[model samples]
Target: MHSILESVKESPGFTTGLRLSDDDLVLVKNAISEHLANHLARIEPDKVPLLQTTALDMYHTIAGQLPHDKLLTRQSRILAQTAVDAIRTTSLFRQLESQLGAFEISDEENVGRESISIRLVRPGFDTDVGSLHADDWFWKLYDFPVPTGKRRVKIWIAICCEQGKSGLILCPNSHKRDWDYSVIERAGMSKPLLSPDENPDKQIFQSKPGDAVVFNYDLLHGGMVTRGERTRVSMEFTMLIPEDVYQH
Candidate 1:
């Protein structure tokens, strides 16, 4: 059998038992739901009672505000704290250094970024999906320097995802090699364009509420939109480790 840590070192990424409790789940769901409804009440007052975001209304104008939403940023901090607490259940965060002393997880984003975000994926083929990409590619695009002695990794926890239905799509083992990309400048911002030949050997990792999916910063990943009805919600955060962990 392949070991978990070894799997992370050798492949695209792996899942862990770390999870949020039932109470935490309720807290996140309610808080975000109310927030989204309130966000719409400002412009579309009649739709407030629609219980949107949970069952998304494609016409809801809130999608334009996702990138800079302050409430989402604050919530990211709160969720990051939850992940740190959940680490007590597994040695993955603290004792992980035993396997690769070059890496470490700070309790907060003291050095890099919160990089924490909440996402809702509505089901159906008509739903818009994110382009194929990797987190670090954007980091480089923005010229954000990874702090010395720290390398980045991503943490994604399923807040309300349906099993085998909706969650993440990762390109297994794609992290080890550089994926060819071009920069497309728009609105004074540069975005990474995945080259045509560098397509992902996509792997759908369906996760449940509270399940944590830690993946490499270079991993080619994206969301899996479902034809089902339920909307998928998930939390994402980032942490760093010693820079040379992967070097010989």
Candidate 2:
């Protein structure tokens, strides 16, 4: 059977309006719901504080890896290589790489290899805000050179509780330029750009469970605060391909 990613590549706007089929969406939602329930059930109320503290530390570390100030916690891997492996084998992710013509690498050790970082964000553990700046740690850590003619792509998977909370908003086509490191460094210098009116091409992805949104790395994008009672959970990662990869 054809994979979802393969199917998406055959259609238009695969990068923009990519969504899961009804059956697939239901499967994703159930998986996410079960995962959360299991984790929550296993945690003791007394240990919750410790878990929150550890999660915060992990969030800061991951955020530092990006060129932004803050990113919503979504999921994590025991090792970086594990995350890389999942991205490589996942049909949805492969389609993304193919659509963007991203660089292919054998493993995480490969300099040009694409990678995905997993994080988990839970309610009460961290506050949800409409906007947050991304850090430039990935460029420095991964040795991804500055953006010239082309840029990398970042995909965020809304794994659980996708009721519009924690959705992303982006300035359309901004990835065609250089990375905006200054925006992250000066995160609170001025009010962070939150709403979509700031740019007409701005697109907000209010994904359903299991839905994923991919955007150019250089694109100006940030997280949206959740107002509902349920926690907003998702996984985010970036795809780094050489400039020549996308040249048609």
Candidate 3:
């Protein structure tokens, strides 16, 4: 087996053994739950707990009704701060930086915060999650500028998921190659989704709330834990690892 850093350097990315503390996990859960509740047009006092119990249903009930971009929330939501703090210390990141020296993290909004977003995937609903594509495509879609001279590693947390059932589905090794694209229907509209030139194998990595996955930004990844009985909620962020090899 490859070491964590070695795996990240050589493959699609590492899928296991990275995590946050139990107490910190709770902080993350509560923070996102509150954020979801506040985004509702009008707070439904009774159904709010569904944010934790069945977020897919909550999205179907509330966020699902809003513009898709509204659902793709920014990290500025106040309650999200508590959640962000806890995620920053996920074991994999600490270890990565320890060996390579510290690097700046960016939310692309905050000067030094990781860019973060929470995702909800409803079972059997293809529109709830996005089509498979590399993260950098979004930068081009929105004309967002990526910082220069930094290597980006994407981080995904299974905030609410079932082990061996629901998690991340990836196109292995796509990060090292360029893939073609075509328009496809997603979220009720035509979107340019990545379609590999050749049929690719799908690799689904199973994970639970405590676990996290880190991968190359160019890797094709999407869809969610869609095999489970309930909705799956997950968080993703990017760490801007410094490329300066000679000095920290």
lDDT of 2: 0.45
TM for candidate 2 is: 0.52
Q: Candidate 2: where is the Cα deviation over 4 Å?
A: 1-14, 19-80, 97-114, 124-151, 173-202
Best by lDDT: 3
Writing each residue's lDDT as its tens digit, candidate 2 over 1-248 gives 12323222232212555555555544444344333333433543343333343323133333333322222222222124434554455556546555654454322334344444334444433444434333233455445465455434456776555465556665555544444232232333333332334443556676766678755444566666544445555656545555554433
What TM-score goes with each of the models?
Answer: 0.67, 0.52, 0.76
Candidate 3 residue lDDT tens string, 1-248: 23544556667555456776677667677777766766643444454455446454245445454543553444333235555666556565576566556765556555354556777776676656776888877665656566788877677888777776667887777777777887666546546677656566678777777688777777788776476666677777777766663123
Model 2: residue 231 alpha-carbon error in angstroms:
2.2
**Candidate 1: where are CA atoms >4 Å away?**
1-5, 34-113, 125-128, 185-189, 242-248
Q: Rank the candidates by lDDT, best first.
A: 3, 1, 2
Residue 160 error, candidate 1, Å: 1.6
**Model 1 Cα lDDT, one tens digit per residue, 1-248:** 22434555576455466566666666665555655566556656764555464244242234444432433333333434443344434433433444445344433434342334567666663334456688888776766667776767677778777788878887888878888888887435467878988767987776777677777777888878854546677767666755555443
Question: Model 3, clash count?
Answer: 2
Count residue pairs with overlapping backbones in model 1: 3
RMSD of each: 5.9, 9.0, 4.4
Measured by TM-score, how close is model 1 to the native structure?
Answer: 0.67
- Decide which is better by TM-score, 1 or 3: 3
Better of 1 and 3 by lDDT: 3
